[model samples]
Target: MKILLVEDEIEMKDSILQYLEMEKYLVEYASDFNLAMQKIHLYEYDCILIDIMIPHGTGLDLIQEIKKIRPKTGIIIISAKNSLDDKIDGLNLGADDYLPKPFYLPELNARIKALMRRNNYEGTSSIVFNEIEIIPEERKVLIHNTLVNLTTKEYDLLEYFLVNKDRVIQKNALVEHLWGDNADQFDNFDFIYNHVKNLRKKLLELQCNDYIKSIYGIGYSFKTIL
Candidate 1:
């Protein structure tokens, strides 16, 4: 999943970034409030971790803006301030969870996973669609009771497609979702097409139906028959 981390402390930010990356999450960070605002406006994230004491403005204000712009996105407050008032204000401002500083990384990860499950999977532990089953926590995909080996990007692509099944997804949206800020480095979406092709091939090899359909000039759709 994609995450935005808004933190000012260099050590804390680096540690969180490293840990989250190790856990296979696409993460982008902003060390100040203004940069955070810029990223929030320009890109989308599955979840955002914000520090209450930030430069130029407060994370509480950021939460309000995020709720107004992307109400469905998950928000978590991570701050050194452990005051009850701060927590209450953040929660009232639509923050989904709060993590006080000096917290364990594993616990933070667990909170993130729980928040994601609640927001995207309706609090379910696994995602099931027909013969395909995905356990997000274990990063495992099983097809017809057999494990399907997939590269990291391939797995992410499949999950994205499954999550938004039956809707047309633009190539640009795929790039942005997968690559985030680095998406600008690519001049074309040929790489995306290749990834999709490979994913289809893998699924077809397992005797799965071709749920993905190209939309001519637009993009692709993952369709399921009613």
Candidate 2:
């Protein structure tokens, strides 16, 4: 999942970013409120960990912006304030959860997972679609109860397709998501096509009808309906 950490403290932001990266999550850091807004406007994140005390603007304003920008985005307020009104206001502003400063990184991870479950997962860790099954917590996938051998990128692509089944995913978005911001620096998107070919071959080998559609000028989409 993609995450944005909006914190003014450089040290804390670096530590949290390192930890989340170690956990295999895509993380972007914004040390101040302006940078935070810029990142938020540019990309969509599964969650935003906003520090209430930020330079230029308060994190509360971010919550309101997220409501308009990415309404499905999960939010967690991490503030040093330990007052009832602070928590209440954040909650009222639509924060899924609030964590105070000086909390353990593991606890923060747990909270992110919990909020993901509440919002995205709908209380489940595994995603079920036709014959494909994905256990997000374990980063595991199965096709008709048979495990498909996949490289890390292949697996990520499949999971992403499953999440947005029947939606046309752009080629550039896949490149950036898998290869980070420097994807355009590469020669081409042939590697993405190769992975898609392999995934399609494997699914067909298993007789799974769900397949990705090439949108000619666009990219690919996971088709569910006939």
Candidate 3:
């Protein structure tokens, strides 16, 4: 899943971003309100983690602004202010959950996972489709109870395809998600083709049906109705 982390604390922001990345989440960080605003306007996030105290504006304002256009956008308010009024205000303003300061990262991660499950996965830890089972927490894929060994990039690409199955995913989005935000430096997408080739081979070797389809001039799709 992709997460937008908005915070001003250097240490906290770095720690959270690194942890999420290690957990195989695509994360974008914004140190101040303006940077945060720019990202909210530019990209879509599965969940947004906002710190109430920021350099230029309170995270409250950000949640309000984002909720206007993105009601389905999952939001969590993290703040040092744990007063009853603050909690009430955040929840009333459409923030999903409020996490007080000095909380553990594991707890925060759990909260995010729960929010994703409620909003997207309908409160499930694993996604099941036909003979394929995806364990998001473990980042593992099981085909009919047998483990399918995949490279890290291959696994992430497969997960991304599974989530957006039957929808066309642009090559640019794949590059951005797999590489860092700046993937334009690449001369071509030969690397992507390599991964796709290898992933297809592994699935075929496991006797799993191939689901990825090319769009000719556009991109690829993980179609189920095929």
In Å, residue 124's CA in model 3 sits off its true spot by 1.3
Specify the highest-lDDT model's number. 1
TM-score of each: 0.97, 0.90, 0.90
Q: Model 1 Cα displacement at 55 (Å)?
A: 0.6
In model 3, the runs with Cα more than 4 Å from the true position are 187-190
Per-residue lDDT, model 1, residue 44, is: 85
Predicted candidate 3 versus true structure: per-residue lDDT over 1-226, tens digit per residue: 7788998888888889889888878898898899999888866678999998898888888999889887889999988878898888888889999999989999999999999888866788988877788888888989888999998889888887887889898787788767655576898775787888899888878888889888887789998985
Tens digit per residue, CA lDDT, model 1, 7-73? 9999999999999999999999999889999999988899999999999999999999999999988
- Greater-TM-score candidate between 1 and 3: 1
Better of 2 and 3 by TM-score: 2
Tens digits of per-residue lDDT for model 2 on 1-226? Answer: 7788999888898899999989888887788889888878877778899998899998988888888878888999999977899889888988999999899999999999889878766688888888888787777778899887777777788877877778888888787777654575988776678889888888789878857888886789998885
Clashing pairs for model 2 are: none
Candidates ranked, most accurate by lDDT first? 1, 3, 2
**Cα-based lDDT at residue 221, candidate 1:** 91
Clashing pairs in 1: none
| Rank order (by TM-score, best first) | 1, 2, 3
Best by TM-score: 1
Q: Quote the positional error of residue 141 for candidate 3 in Å.
A: 0.3
